[model samples]
Target chain A: MTEAVLAADDHALLKTQLSSALRRQKLSAFLLVAPLLIFVTATFIYPIAGMLERSTYSPEFALEMPRTAAALAPWDGTDVPGDEVFEALALDFKDSKTRQATGRLANLVNVELPGARGLIMKIGRGVDRLQPPYREALVALDNDWSKPEIWQALYGLSKAYTSRFYIAALDLKINRQGEITTQPEDKRIFLPLFLRTFWIGALVTLCCLLFGFPVAYWLSVLPMRYANLLMILVLLPFWTSLLVRTTAWIVLLQNQGVINSLLVWTGAISDSNRLSLIFNSVGTIIAMTHILLPFMILPLYSVMKTVPFSYMRAARSLGANQYTAFIRVYLPQTKPGVAAGCLLVFILSLGYYITPALVGGESGTLISNMIAYQVQKSLNWGLAAALSSLLLVGVLLLYWAYNRLAKVDGFKLG
Target chain B: MSLPVYARPWERLWYYSLRAFCIIVLLFLVMPVLVIIPLSFNAEPYFTFTEGMLKLDPAAFSLRWYRDVLENGMVNQDLPVASWAWLSDVWQNSQWVHSAKNSFSIAIGATLLSTLLGTLAALGLSQEAMPARRFIIALLISPIIVPVIVTSASMFFLFAKLGLTNNYLGIVVAHTVFGAPFVVITVTAAMAGFDRSLIRAGQMLGAGPLVIFLKIIMPLILPGVISGALFAFGTSFDEVVAVIFLADYEQRTIPRQMWAGIREQISPAILAVASILVCFSILLLMVMEVLRRRAERIRGVTPA
Candidate 1:
């Protein structure tokens, strides 16, 4: 009985130690992973969150021209209100050179607000500093400072968070009636550019697949010794600058380029170098496909390397023709690689900026180019952020869709 | 098959034709870069037909353009003063050199930091005790999935607000953000086939964690680390969009400088610069391939 009691005591001791050990393991894992986790969160997650925040960022026009914005808030949009709102706005306008500030507010009102340019010009010429004349001029325009439409606009602009940027990006707007409506017919098509961007990306991906697949297959079938040598040929361009490659295409495809000269020399075309290849869709595709071809081939080759030849040979021995044997046996095995290559090419094509910007001229520009112009030229960070967020969301959705499809297809690529 | 004579003359002809077509395609792929290298050395600036297109021209070589580029002083577009006084006074300015330094600094800082972190993460991940390993793996590589442009734009606003956009630390941090994913991939791959007991043996010998890492783990995974560093350097060197938006004049990188040059003008100077950049990247790639082969040898993958 004493020995049994001792054994029970030993079991109790072991249980206590085991539980503590388990807890320590958990703590250790948390410690090990914590630095990386926090780093990612602080550097990546936080920055993206801040970007989303900037999308809704609004300049404090209310603080600067409170009297004007307040006085105008109660006025109706269709008819001019009591003179106080206008007077206050005019006073503020006279008192301040708020082109940068007021232009943002105007964009909130309408991106291309009529007379807003004049407002900027007036402010630029009139307001050297905040003075009595400026205030007096503002007070003389109108008195009612609480017009609903004006307040709505101001309120929309006041918050550091609002859907206005995204709404504007989609070519829709909040009407004076406080309802979202389609933009004017001519202006109702912001989404078309986005659609066009996707269309171009898809077309480029298709082109790469069409061109890349056969070459990749040929490389796969070639002797290993020769294939390795040829693979270097594919990779040689990667050593060159992307700009150099794109510019080389520009040199080759231009109207007075080697292609034109050769075609004319061969009598393939008439004397006139009629083809305007540069600064067109054809140039954009040709350059981008050439640049991205390796991306497709590499993934396909990696997949093909592991596939056994016996599967095809077995199918052939079963009375299938060579084409049928290859298709039935070899092709099924390559689906995963093909999907991976297509996804890589397609997704990469979506973010292309330089090629499209350089080669596409007016019509071939992608969404990224527009975003760049907005940031650098127009100085429209909010709109740029909103558009980028759309793109980010679009890419994320695509990745998610690809993950789902890849799982179903059982294809894998790093 | 030989006894049956299943293949006809036309079939053999078709196969041979296909092979020839493949050869031509291979030649097409190889010719462009080959053409550019020689063109870069041509005495004449234009890319017209060479004197001996099929035959080698020993006398046609000239370093005049390269010398002109190196000897001429670089002047600021905004200000006419010499950028750098040495050689052509252009080299006297710190713009190109400073930017190159920044790129190197950021790339090296990012690569070293990420490689260390990735190695540790890989060790922790390889251990079965780690919870949610698959989820963590996915999250770590999420940057590879997100489009770089969006990342750059998003980071631009974030950094500008934080006053980090134009700073060296900011660029390092941005580079590190992208660089970590590559390290994780390569180092994880290296560790995938690594033996666990070698580390355990070190532990049993009373070696500390740091000691084991240095003495045992690092040697085994050094190739992956090196390759990851090469990739990081190349990425930071070639990266333009982020650097363009984030950097001002003081922080402009080489790629950014080249990009501006390209957009604004076409010059033989750019060709010289391109050739230089190409040489640098190829050197890095060659070093990487050597290290990779060494790593494979360590892992018992026989070299072809």
Candidate 2:
């Protein structure tokens, strides 16, 4: 009985020791990845979160013109707000810090209210000489100040957490009746741009597949010596600078460029009938397909390498014709690679900025180009963020499908 | 592909046509880069080949465009090429030189940062005991998968808030985030080939973790690590969108300058820069090919 108790005690001691060692191993492993994990989170995740936050969060007008926003907040939007709201606006305009600050507030409001910027600025310019009853004076300074749409739009901008940017991104706005309505026809670019972006992405992916399949099959069937050499032809461009490749396309495809010159010289077409190749959706698709063709080929080639040739021989021996052997037998085995490559190229093309922006002229621009314009030119970051979020969601959804359907081990590239 | 004796004439025709189609596709892939090299050397200010160039006249192939690459932004263009003032002016005032410096410095900083952190993370990830490995792997590599515009736009907010935009360190950090994934991929691939028995033997022999890593794991993974670094360097060097969003004029890189040149004016000086960059990439590709072959040959060898 004493010996049995001693054995039990030793067993408990060993169990505790083993558990502690396992814990140490886990801890050390966590410690190893912790630095990079934290770095990615800080620089990558945090910024993306901040971008999402920016789309829904614009407190500039509300915080900058606090009393006016607060006073304008409670109106039911049935009509023009009372004199109290007008007095608050007059005071806020008069007491605002700088001309730029007033302009900034006016700009934000004008995005929703249309004519509010000039009206607000007019009232601000003429406010110093205004009388005690500020409502009459404010409306007199600019007749637009009395409009219910202006007041309603101001109320919408007052909230710290807003849907205005997202609404605008969807090409909708809060009408005077305070219900969401479609943007005026000319302002309806984002939704259409998003659609066009997807269309371009699909078209480019189709092009890549059509071109890539033959090359990948050729590489897979070739001897290792020639395959390796030709693989460099594919990869050198892959490794070349994106700008360099883009420059090459521009040089080759412009109206006065190499391809057109050769065509004109060969009498294939009249000199006046030069093809407009670059700066259009056609160019966007062509350049993008060229840029992304290797992405499709690489995955297809790797997968095809593993597929045995005996399957083809077997199918042929079973009285199938060559085309039937390929279609019935060979193609089925490459579905996973096809899916992976298609999804990859499609996902990549959706977010393309530089290639599309450079080659894509007025009609050929993608949603990403519009987002860039919003950020850099218009300075409408909120709308930019919202549009980006839409694209991001689409990409993430496709990626989720890729994970489920393709069974991707990890994202591998050279 | 060798034909079987049972092949018919139609089958032979189909096979040759397929060969022709692939060769044409191959031309489509390579013709653009090849076409640029000859046009970049044009004596005239035209993008298309001149008649003289076609005729192989020496007058049509002056290195003037290459000279223009050096002298485009020189403050004193009239100074003699052999003079010290001209050389110094080229160094200080040339637009391409400044961009080249910016690209190299940024690429190097990103390479060092990525290679170090990525190698460490890869080591942890290669181990079986790592917690939430799949999720972590997905997160770490998400930068590449995420649209760059979103990433750049996203990072713009952070950098703007932190006052990190308009600085080299910000671009460096941005590139490091991008390049770290390649390091992770390559190093993990190398570790996947490593023999667990060797590491176990080290443990059995009472060698410490650091000692085993230094003596065994390091040697095996060194080629992978170096190639990964090159890939990282190449990535940062070639990247433009981030630089477009994050960098100001003083921090412009070669690709950005090329972008402006292509957009605003079509100059063969830009093409000269392109040729130089092409040579540089060929050098990088050669090195990578050698390293890849070495890694394959070394994959399953047991360390003595």
Candidate 3:
């Protein structure tokens, strides 16, 4: 039978035609795609790479005060060895104000030792002294100031650019006084916060999936005209502003809002009831679930639409009950939608800032909230970049993991 | 085994219950946005019951807030008295726009740059020529995945040295970067349904690559191009962080201004602006749908 089928296939002509068409297609595609390649390279790739370089490359210590950095480059930590190093430091300091260079210098030294700030400040204070032992005086103001550790800090800061910020973000500290250490156990808050962010995101995504799946299934099975109208309702939130949606939630969930009023009127709760729903983690979960439910529903409905009714009927006819048929057969078929919806919700929730910031009290804030505070309020770009890098890595890892699972499971989400 | 009448009764009950449940879900989803349209005209800006309020207070129907926003020109009048108060005089000291002209200029410039980059990306991506296309596409659009805060934080120092910070160009560049990925995604989807034969035919007809792009490819993907442009415009218009970090005194966009307004004062003016934006987005969504349908017709794909 196979041989008979193969004999009728006309394979040679098909191969020849397919090969020629594909090559022609490839060349045409490359030509058409060139401009976009160049544009992405310049705008997307170049600028971000430039940003990474700017953050990691220490130019203050290495680029601006090269000669001074060179002079201190060879000094071992044992002694206050070279006058030339001190002279170079003084010259760099004299040419610049305490404001411009000193703060950056402090940041570099800060990587190694927490007390480096005071040491650097003392050095700045002694810069104007006209004494015989001025170098010794500056170094003696803090004994560690002359230690190779201080020089390293100065040299590090002087180079003006490095990945020290990135290092600090991971909660690792460097020091001449001590080896790089995990931030003191008490101060190590970010890791916990990062985990909390993931937990919250996962919970919200789960809530959305649970609430959306049944509704999407029902919607998909509806008559076409009714489904279209219902789908519009599902999508109406997309037309509303995000700010408005969040603000509405805030109002609705508040103590004096319609929800509480209704509860009181129906005698579901006391008239004196004062609920604390809007400012806590529960509020964050509820609001996010509401906002993201449609993301889950859309994917589910799209997938469920293509699911043939025969599959379930076949399972049922095979002596399986309706519940068993759905659990074993229909659920597996909905995997693609489940994956897509979960991915969308998880990814979006990971980066969510505005809603959590507005509604989330201390317990509800996510990694995005911390990142915002670092940039806008604290003005700590290095730490912000560090935290952001962590979040980025996390998101990429989750995406990669999901894609790998999909590949292994033979699940293709459109 | 059961009679049809007995079995049919249970089915009817199930169907009715399902329909009722679906209707309730629909009502929950649509009510919020529909509520706002009428509430925008409400004398009270608060999201409370308005029928009784509107009936008792005819003065509330007066477009006083809208008039105040337009005539007082408050959006252009003072720097929002918060973190942005320091930036109130930025234009006098720099080339930033203190007027609506500046906002228009920045949005337009960012939109153009982003659209060009994004459309090209979409076309390239649609062709599927590059090695490891999925991986490359993912990386290329990774900006959207990297939260905006991270991008802004990283760009702050980079732009500062490029002398792009605190200037119009700086804000525009930041906006362009943020907007490009959305453009890429939308345009790429549009190009996915596009036929490759037309471009091949153009090439065979002796048109140069650029000519084929302008005369053949562009017209075919024009809807995608337009969609990308609209997305880019919205992205820039709505961006807050990168502009907040990169722009100094002169380059405040509407969102940046709004952020300050929210923190510093309780102005109803923001609601007016937001109402306008809601209208704009709806109008824009309509246009995108029309273009999408037109593109489908050109490609000879049956409309759903």
Q: How high is the CA lDDT of each candidate model?
A: 0.69, 0.87, 0.67
Across A1-414, the per-residue lDDT of candidate 2 in tens digits comes to 999999999999999999999899999999999999999999999999999999999898788878978887788876899989888887787777445477777677777666667877776577678887988887677777777777777787788898888898899977667799998888798899999999999999998998899889989888877888898888888888888888889889999999999999999989998999999988888889889988998988988888899999999999999999999999999998899999999999999999988898877789888888888887788889999898899998998777766644445564
| Candidate 3 iRMSD in angstroms | 4.5
Q: What is the lDDT of residue A161 in candidate 1?
A: 53
Which segments of candidate 3 are over 4 A away from where they belong? Answer: A1-28, A54-56, A62-126, A139-167, A174-177, A254-273, A279-283, A401-414, B1-28, B36-62, B71-108, B128-132, B194-223, B291-304
Please provide, for model 3 over A27-98, each residue's C-alpha lDDT reduced to its tens digit, 9 standing for 90 to 100.
Answer: 665654556566556645665565556456656456546667777667654446478777776766554444
Pairs that collide, model 2:
none
lDDT winner between 1 and 3, please give it.
1
Model 2 backbone overlap count: 0
Show where candidate 1 strays beyond 4 Å: A1-30, A57-59, A67-78, A81-84, A87-115, A121-160, A174-178, A184-189, A221-224, A404-414, B1-30, B50-61, B72-91, B94-99
TM-score for candidate 2: 0.96
TM-scores across all candidates? 0.85, 0.96, 0.78
Question: What would the per-residue lDDT of candidate 1 be over residues A1-414, giving only the tens digit for each residue?
Answer: 999999999999999999888778766765666666678778887877777777776555666677766775565544345656545656665544444465545544443343344444444454554344433443233232233444455455544456888888888988877688888878754587788788888887887777677777777776765776677677766555677777677667777656776687679998664588879778887788888877787778877877887787688789987789878888899897788788878877888888888788877788888888877776677888888888888887777666654531232222
Q: Positional deviation of A128 in candidate 1, in angstroms?
A: 10
Question: lDDT score, residue A276, model 1?
Answer: 85
Clashes of each: 35, 0, 15
